[model samples]
Target chain A: MTVLVTGVGVVLPGGGRLADLGRTEAGSLEPVDPRSRINRRGLRYKDRATQLAFCAAEEALNDAGLYAPAAEAPVRAEIGIVVSSNFGNLDTVCRVTGTIGAEGTLAASPMDLPNASSNVIASSLAIRFGLAGANLMLCSGATSGLDALSWGRRLITAGRCRQVLVLGTEPDNETVREFTDTPRMLDGAVGVVLEDAGTAAARGAVPRLTLGTACRGGTLADCVAVLAAHGAPARWYPPEAVTADVLDGLFPGATRVDLAQVWGASSGALGVLQCAAAIGWFDGGGAGPVYAVTGGGRDSAAGHVFTAPPGVAR
Target chain B: MSAVIAGAGAVSSVGRSVDDIFTSLCGGRSGVGDLRVFDRTRYRAEHAYEMDDRPPGGPDVPLRTTRWLLAAIEQAARSGGLGDDLEGVPVLVGTGLRELRSVELRHRGAADIGPADLHFGPAVRERFGATEIHTLANACAASLSALALGADLLDAGEADAVVVAGTDMITESMFGLVERVSAVPPDRVRPFDRDRLGAVMGEGACAVVLRRSADARPALGVLRGVGINCDAYHVTAPSPAGMAAAMRQAYQRADRSPTETDLVMLHGTGTMLNDEAEATALTEVFGDRAGRPLMTAIKSMTGHTSGASGLLGLIVALRSLHTGAVPPTLGLENPVPEAAPLRIVTELVEGPSLSTAQINAFGFGGINAVAIVERAR
Candidate 1:
């Protein structure tokens, strides 16, 4: 019943396309419309969150080589979609609520109501790709991204879907501003394609790692400790572990990467950034096990332990 | 995969607990009363089933809605005989108003609010000690969506048990929205009646403890499947032809035909457009067999509970399956002339063992959700 991750794609504050995100960028991370570059029209109406999801989904499908033709092939109808966000469509919500509050009730615009929905991203993707399987949106604050990942793994392990597109997305808005005074509300998306070991091997897909047991703890400290016991590097810490003293306690030898410098201090998008960091470290031919901790003040934490591939130095 | 309703609870104008509400319902009592939830002197709708009994505190309950939500969850846990603390249990709450009161207070300049003041997710977490909590704001369909997602979590093995709650209280802001939509009536809600004008507003909260069938107690019914569909046609009005796709999807997922259903718990908001569309959808889907499934509209008695309507209907369906009798549809003296020839239940009648029931909840944003529940032998 174990699920394996075959591919990972990300659109984050670190800039670059999904393929280039993991590698060193020549310049700073900048926001670019991947859809526009790809000549996809009518994408202007989509918010940054939806755009991020499209970019990541496109990249993941490309990496897995699951094109429209392949998706429409005579395979089982078993592709589930699980998308999660903390402040889902916060930008849209703020706009709608502000409009309703400022203007008279009768004057409230209807254009923004659809965008305020938490499931808009997933629903849009499903309609675009004709994915008629299970679709769910999880909004559990900081842990939402991991929750989606867990559900995707479960779908594969339970034989409900041959593969699942687990997306983690967040768009910057006033809600993010209220959470952190700093501009941490970065916009990004990451999608991981999960499949069972049998299906993966049948398709000649080499899994990067076996998705392991995910447990929720009462607090971030407890979560970190549990992950550490399961082989997570002790140097990793929660997002709040940014204080100098806490950083000293966690990462002793590693030089800190100022994530805020590239992507703001947003909570939900941190998971995508962390996933990007893990992929970056792996692509750089790093050795041993690298731990990625993503969570915030909501007491939500997801620890991912990445072990180097064989022949990679420890 | 089967999902069992391990525990259920409700806090409405009908009653605060399941047993209390069931007794009142069986006795054919109505919960409709004066509209005290807001200043109704200026409004046309002056009657509703407003929950006036506060739980040991005033309006300052962190998130005002969370107080009622906690009570319902606690009742569900108690009824299910679960002793485990909800330390790590995922919480999914369906609410049309995520602290609507708080927003009103801020708008009136009665209180200064922060980001946390905008919603109920954090308040529920603090009250129930959930490991993770999610809030769904799909209007009337919110609770059904929460239940559907919770069932998915169990089916996917995400959690051993989940607490899914739906809560909303009457708010002036929401009333304004209702007034604008022309869905609010001047007095009591009368569903499926020829003289029905519109729906009266009400407020309530309901929760269900969902678990895998293997882990649940033997007495509860089984949640067979749930189907959800959204019509991108309009934000306020339903799809012109009705949610035919959603109905088909529900039956398809349940592995049953419209003829196999024993009862249909209609949304029956008493709104002219809503009732007509529902009747058309039913006739189109079921045809001659539409009358075979005994139909009842509970909103006539309880008023429109908004987000809690889905769970309220779920509770009533469970009761019907247990008692082998369907509750009467109140306030339907004369059926609409154009309505389908369905067997509208006007008086409670003992019938054959009801095997399956379908509950539908349509929201403001064209969100349609239907859940099929089966009697667990």
Candidate 2:
């Protein structure tokens, strides 16, 4: 049985709230409003990566309508949490290391230590939702996002979990500055609610895309070529290209508003843009086939392809 | 879905490969020696099984430990008679120190440790042209977690095969950290021994190629199941009850009863708390039947290889299954009084055709992993 993505969500460079970002169309980046939906207390406390994840997860759960009593039954003990990050709290690690090096171990704050762990995000999510099933935090540089999705699909297919929350979030780090000597780091998060297609359909859950095989490569060219050979229009987007490349790749000359100009570089946020793009096109009464590409260094890349629902484009 | 161990490799202080380590273990040799990799003159424990010579694969590549791991993988693949194109095969590498060399350089005020140190995954990816790479850093359980992830991936059909590798070498930064934790003994590792003080640090690398049973050669032992859990009890100290939950989960996944377990490759670090916890956990899971299972600790001879310990245990279990002789638990002259009345192998003991072996690894941050191996027909 193939695992399908029933719902998707994102929080990225453009906006804070799911609704605010949900209206985004693929064209150019847009400036985010400070008072947007993501300005909540708990959301504000989170680092950029955590913030993105929270937004994406919230949207996913909302779309699945899984926040009600039925989905929250006590006997539903098969919900698993799996998240992947390229750097895994690199920002917090840098802070703790600097503090320890300068002020000695005794002066280190207790709060900083827990936050520095790679599993902090997964642990926090587990605590939040009372998910006690298998939890894993995978770190494999850039490919971590796709790997997490692949693993989540496996868990669902293997009947280990009835529903799996798979999230991939990466925030800009000081390491980006230190190594690239450039300040162009993108911060965002993406999540997909994966469930067995038969089970999901029975539960009245609508799937946005039927996920296929996820593959990775050692080099960017190889990644693009392999994906393209698999019927995906894999194209490389330079840093300056922004969402223009994405919109062009997906719709060619289709009329759409470019939000990248206002949002800036989304980086890991491409997944978010794709979700928003799908929704925007659907809402705007214009669509056929839509494709999205998200890539990052550390060899991270995720691509999603889907077709519009019938009668929407007609 | 079962995954078979198609290939295995190692490079430790005992020897450069599995053959060398096994030969030395059969001869009852010890690899613990004075620490030479780093100047530990100021530290409390000055002994370690440091990898003295350049790893069997030519010159060191600055900060990347993946180079050594790749070498071991190459050896394992050659032994397993596998192909060079690891495309579409998942690569999971485990390590206690992701970039220890980078840490050392930063401590010494080096401006940059180069791209090699900054990006460790790409180094391995470039070498073998892997389709995917997953790096895990869970202290001691890193490699075991990698094995578990491999099993999960295979069961998920993410790949036809997976390469799980664990590697850790003694570094100045790691030496300092161990000294601070005070887990290192002044002498050698004496696991489960009454007078055991602490663990002896060591350096090594081990890799195993795993494939679905259908794709695996009939000769290789099958990786039956893998169980992993977080204790969430303590950071450094294990649950006094040991990893009962984790072990139960493992046995349940393996579909085996406690009495069916033929042997146990313990994660005996020789520390007082570690020994006590392991014994307690074993007793709880097996009850009176626990004492019937043949138990041994290999760290007394190989020293504690941190992330690589669990993989070494797997290698030892495979060798034991092959030879039908369980290796003795060296440095365990006087067993702890509180330990279970299990038949501890104090000397190399010839045994019946062993069908099942469990390898256990508990890491810092309360990470615990158990891997079950079944002898192939």
Interface RMS for model 2? 4.9
Q: Which 10-residue span in candidate 2 chain A carries the lowest summed lDDT?
A: A232-241
> Candidate 1: what is its chain A TM-score?
0.82
What are the DockQ scores of the candidates, in order? 0.17, 0.20
| Model 1 lDDT tens row, B1-377 | 57888888888888888877776666667788876644444455567777776444444323456678878888887776564367667778887655556545544454465544444555665666666676666567778877777877887767788888888876555564455455435477788898887877777788888877545356567787776655534445665343665677678766778888898888888888778777878888888887788888888777888777888888778888888877778888888864648787888768668989989887764667788888868
* Model 1: DockQ vs. true structure: 0.17
Fnat, model 1, is 0.12
Q: Candidate 1 chain B — worst ten consecutive residues by lDDT sum?
A: B54-63
The candidate scoring highest on DockQ is 2
Local lDDT at A95 for model 2: 55
RMSD of 1: 5.2
Error of 1 at B37 (Å): 6.0
